[model samples]
Target: MNGIDIHNYVDCNDMFRAAANFFAACCRCAVAEKGVFNVAISGGSTPDGLFEELVKMKDSLPLEAIQWFWVDERCVKPDAPESNYGRAAKKLLNRLQLQLDNVHRIEAEKPEAAEKYEKIIRTLLPLNKKGLPVFDLVLLGMGPDGHTASLFPEKFNDLPGDKIVLKVPEPEHILPAVPRITLSMQAINSALEKVFLVTGNNKMELLKVIKNGQGNHYPAAGIFQAAWFVCCKPGSQD
Candidate 1:
């Protein structure tokens, strides 16, 4: 990756540990400096291990100073199995005793979920010079087809530049296919730090395309100054 920093690990466990440690470090630093650590996290099975690892470190983390937000959400109730907030809540938040108010989940089932989420982000996060909310950290995951935070390849060109959150009503081909609400590319790029957690041997070839910078059509490739925490070693097979 021309503009990305690559951190390779031998396996999924190692990769999750490294990413969790990185997240903890960022949380401590941000909370120490500004009294708050605001972060937006992506959904998917890939990050579940990282969430579990973080839960194990609950005693050391400044849970009170951390504010949680989601990068995107499916159009389902919070209790649904596929819901990102639901997964994190079960694996991490509930374990850490994080207050409900600090968890800013996107209510994707509502008609104005995107607008409501944008308002909440603006209210809680500090804005940069360009007036974009700056999150202390943004944890992301890249789909096998190169999508990130619900930004798919088919509608890459049609994404709104001025919006903080976008309502994705047409996600017909993707798994768990349904409506979604996601942060715009502008919102993601404005974050102070962004990291992508990529594991599994099946993703090596797609990672190659991203690393070579030939995936302009892919949403994950367009992220600004991203660090890739990858465990899929070259030549590894399932």
Candidate 2:
């Protein structure tokens, strides 16, 4: 928490640029330190924008040294329109043309995909002092209900302490219905750093409540220890 930072952007484009720059810098640092950058990508409209920026950065960034993972995945086909991996592949991976060995996606359509992905992550990345994988960075999106990744408020406490990944139970009536696999709070909290990209006026009031410290009940509060880059307070623009 002491190292966490928060930023606000005037628009999504600005947020995307800031995210891309930070990610590139992190990747470079990871490469210099350990020869690889292990990052988890979040699925959502906001990250699509960030991925767009990443695509444009292919030539300048340390693309080959980066290893990618999903923060969470819907139990759908990898190419499904709603799939986070699908969106990212189209927006960034395809265009960046990074190595196949560097990209690890959750086979969410499989019955044991959650466990399988956990094992894959374990084999590829080093564990921190907590025995949890320390992702260099994990990009997170906050839903209107304040859910981050697939971790909803109602089901947060039920997550097993030792499990790195788990099948998410259905959300409490507000979110879209879909089976999801998510990294546990321990895994998420273990990241070396995290970024929360929040946008638009719809979330302004909720953001105010969160900033005022009245949102302890929200799932996003679980990672309030991470960096947050919100946007365009009410009506102002870049």
Candidate 3:
């Protein structure tokens, strides 16, 4: 891989454990260095397992000292099944003892959600010299078509690289085809850590493209210094 560090796992469970361990370590390090760990997480089937694994390590991780944010959110009410915040809240937030103020969910149903989220980030997280909020970690998941966050391949050329938050139009190719609000590439790349949780043999071909650095058309390939945690059948890398 040109810029990605690949970690292979025999199955999704093992990959989730490795991801959870990495998350816990990052939380501890960030909390120890500062007072809180600011992390932004994505929503997907892959991360659902990681969220469960994280619950098992609640005692080991600095749950109370960690500030959670969303990488992207579908334009739905918080209780909607398609709501990313709803999924995270059920799978992780409700399981941990975190500060209510630290859970920064994207209220995507509101028209001003993107602007509000951008303001919130500037108000809470530390800003870099470029004026972008620097997060301790930004956890992401790659769709089979190579989309990360709500940045789909069809809309790659349209995304503003300098924006903090972007209002994404409804994707025609992907499911839950609703409009979304997402952190822009500039915001995501400003994070201290960037990770992708990718599993299943269906993603092998795209992973190959991304690993060989030939996936410039794919939104996930635009991520800087991304580490991919992949799980698939043994020898699938060949």
Candidate 4:
């Protein structure tokens, strides 16, 4: 089994660079093999820096051939302030001048949005050996409370079985709580590559536990075959 690999950095700039390099590689590999690169991005304060770095990659990579997707989303209007789709647009997509059709966003506000988004994903992506739609790359962020995407600690083991996408309601076990739609574990694990962008001292202890392999109890550790780009205060041991 491919386990999680951790890489620590002194600042987010280096972290974003590493992620952008890995991202460029995934894009090239996917495009060469399938003519399109499917990418899913998580919404958080951490990935914003990575997005900024990626926009500058237009000169070095095939930016136009890349298609974008969201890893999870708040159940709000697409243009809403809290929407992940909105955040990504402001941070990177608009800057890239990507063909608007290539940026697929989840209509999280619709009553049937989960099913609708799942259909969109299925129609847009190719399947892995496991018969799941495999994204070329999936970028994630871990909550200080140990959640990844919207699979919170409170509902870690309870994500929907048959659905490719799940709806998460705010629960007492999580902080910064809100309703959300997220890919299921099976869907996320099927990615060709999974990269986590972790930053700040707030996550230091959590990263320690995760590195020590004590994070199985937390929702964030459920993602498989992942690499973490961590930036934190000094003296934090790997």
lDDT of predicted model 4: 0.84
lDDT by residue for model 2 over 43-148, one digit each (tens)? 8778878888888888888888889999998888988887889988988888888799999999998999998999998999899877799899999988887788
- Alpha-carbon RMSD, candidate 2: 2.2
Most accurate candidate by lDDT? 3
- All candidates' TM-scores? 0.96, 0.93, 0.96, 0.93
Once model 2 is optimally superposed onto the true structure by TM-score, how far is the C-alpha of residue 176 displaced, in angstroms?
A: 3.6
Against the reference, the lDDT scores of all candidates come to 0.89, 0.83, 0.90, 0.84
Instruction: Give the alpha carbon lDDT tens digit for every residue of 1-238 in model 3.
Output: 4478989988889999999899988888999999899999998767988999999988888677998999999999999999899989888898896779889999999999999999999999999999999999999989888899999999879878778999999997998989999999889999999999988788988999988989998889989888899988866653
Q: Rank the candidates by lDDT, best first.
A: 3, 1, 4, 2
lDDT of 3: 0.90
Clashes of each: 0, 0, 0, 0
For model 4, residues 1-238, the per-residue Cα lDDT tens digits are 2388888889779888888888988899888887889999998678888888888888877777888998999888888888889989999888888898898888888878888989989888987666688898999998888888888887777766767898878767654456888998889888889999998788888878877778888877878889988888686553
Residue 5 of model 1, lDDT score:
88
What's the residue-level lDDT of 211 in candidate 2? Answer: 67
What stretches of model 2 exceed 4 Å from their correct place? 1-4, 236-238
Model 1 Cα lDDT, one tens digit per residue, 1-238: 5488889888789889999999999999999899999999988888888998998898999999999999999999999998988988888788888888899999997898998999999999999888889999999998877899999988878878888899876565787988889998889999989999988788778888888989888899999798899887667775
- Which ten residues in a row are the worst by lDDT in model 4? 170-179
lDDT head-to-head 1 vs 2, winner: 1
What's model 2's TM-score? 0.93
Q: For model 4, name the residue pairs that clash.
A: none
List clashing residue pairs in candidate 1: none
